[model samples]
Target: MQSLKEGLLNRAFSHIYVEKRAMEYELTKEILKRFKESKVIEIEHYKDIFSRANQDFYLQKKSPKLILAVKQNNLIYKGADVCEDFGNKHFYYTSIMMNCIYDCEYCYLQGMYTSANIVIFVNLDDYFKEINRLLSMHPLYLCISYDTDLLALEGLTNYVKKFIEFAKENSDLTIEIRTKSANFNLIKHIQPQDNIILAWTLSPEGVIQKYEHRTPNLKRRIKSIKEALDRGFRVRLCFDPILYIKNWRDEYRDLIEEVFSNIDADKIYDVSIGLFRVSKDYLKRMRKQRPDSIVLNFPYDTVEGVCSYDKELSRNMIGYVYGLIARYVEKEKIYI
Candidate 1:
């Protein structure tokens, strides 16, 4: 058996698959510098590796590889129904990368993608150009980091900084960068902009310890949010996808209290409260991936292809949390 340290070293990007075209990009070159010891293999397209079959997602996640490629088409997508649009008429989301570094047991990425290896598109200029074209028509509310946690991978991709600068220049564009990472050093130096909303997803400490693998604890994330608020950034608190655990109400109540005690609610841009929901197909696939996971195995009701708690349970969950948050935040700024 391999020692734990040796196993970790083996899993940490032993090989890097780079597209022949992406090899020329400066971002690709910078990423290569960080993994000099890993073997570099050139491919014609990233899908050649990322879309392969018979791959074990769980095993590959032990030490996922890196795929650097250029995005050729479909730069932006319409936001899904499950996602909160915040009443924006021109709401959309774009994925510069796929698959997250963290191993959250309830993450939808596990079912959405066939591989656990991370894919980073090196051509972000193209994404910005597409956004600019859309902006020409009307104002846009874009979610820049939906499929992956861009902030956590900021050291390798530097996309968060680039997006912040992009949002700073385009006043008509409001970008939401949601993350569970505590890597505040990446954005501490840059000045925050009103158009750029830094949204952090918070879960109870019990949930974080049980389900959210490799993610920062609740306290660390709160500290990062405090720093962002102090720097004049528009911060949004998200108690989304509140897990249904034993004593969930008490757990979440304590979580809310802990959150409010640390920061001033007046500075918050908004708060979003949502109960757990996932696509019916995605949940089916998730069940096949990890059949033993208690969180994934819940018997949720399906409505129009979306699986979630029964209507009454979901209503109570959202309503209870909404009531808790409303005490600290204004009702007008809260979204369900």
Candidate 2:
């Protein structure tokens, strides 16, 4: 067990809710040991609290309680169309953790979930068991960290480190751990695996400050990417959900240049780009949660149950950003 560090909020878990059946799991015991100062209460099930009526997701975000429970079903799921597949036929994702510590307004998790508390499913072994069973069918492209930032909570859970080791043992399974946390040092000593892709989401400093709350600044994330590359890890840069804020062109142009200037584009696995788009249901919930947020309050056009900037604007924005990045990275290595 590695020595645990403080959370991104610079505070320990004040209160931790543990499921009755989950207490015996090794992962649960490891987490409990890390946060000895937290108040632990055993519960029958996670949904009893996680699904309570009107949990005020926005207010609870200021100080979200931690929930450790056993994931009884749906250990893994097929990738959704809203998410980019990068043309992989065997794409899938698993949510070992629910909700994120960082509160980015553009994040779809806010609108998807009714509660804001953090839930870490301590049944990762079951996940791997199911994945290995499916691997017998064919190769897999797995997104290990979906709807949560495992890297940011690494100090408290160390789940990312565990996933890296699993990927190392199974070369047939390709795993992508996308994150905004600059916590690469936690696993710097571990050998890098070819199947493990470290995908980092990047935005301009100004945009990060104004919209991406509680996330590391552009410089810190880029520095971490450089370190990961220097350590021979396969790195990927995600410019998805490109916010349509004022001066977006200048912001993204400079962001791309800054990324290529510090990162060797040739060494990166691939770069992905997408404009901000949300499901109709999520957008409705987001409007109620953040009535005044410029990111969510935009009068986006709806098409086929999804909402986003108009088609022409989306094309231009994606085109301009792609043009800038193409100069640094080969077009074949880029994903729309």
Best by lDDT: 1
Error of 2 at 138 (Å): 0.7
Per-residue CA lDDT of candidate 1, range 148-267, in tens? Answer: 999999988889999999998999999999999998778899888889999999999999999999999999999999999999999989998898899999999999999999999999
C-alpha root-mean-square deviation, each candidate? 1.7, 4.8
How does each model score on TM-score? 0.97, 0.95
Candidate 2 deviant stretches above 4 angstroms: 1-12
TM-score of 2: 0.95
lDDT of 2 by residue, 87-168 (tens): 8899999999999999998888888999889999988889999999989999899997879998999987878899999988
Query: Which 10-residue span in candidate 2 carries the lowest summed lDDT?
Result: 1-10
Best-matching candidate per TM-score? 1
Enumerate residue pairs that collide in model 2.
none
Q: How accurate is candidate 1 locally (lDDT)?
A: 0.92
Q: Which 10 successive residues of model 1 have the least lDDT summed?
A: 1-10
Query: lDDT scores for all predictions?
Result: 0.92, 0.89
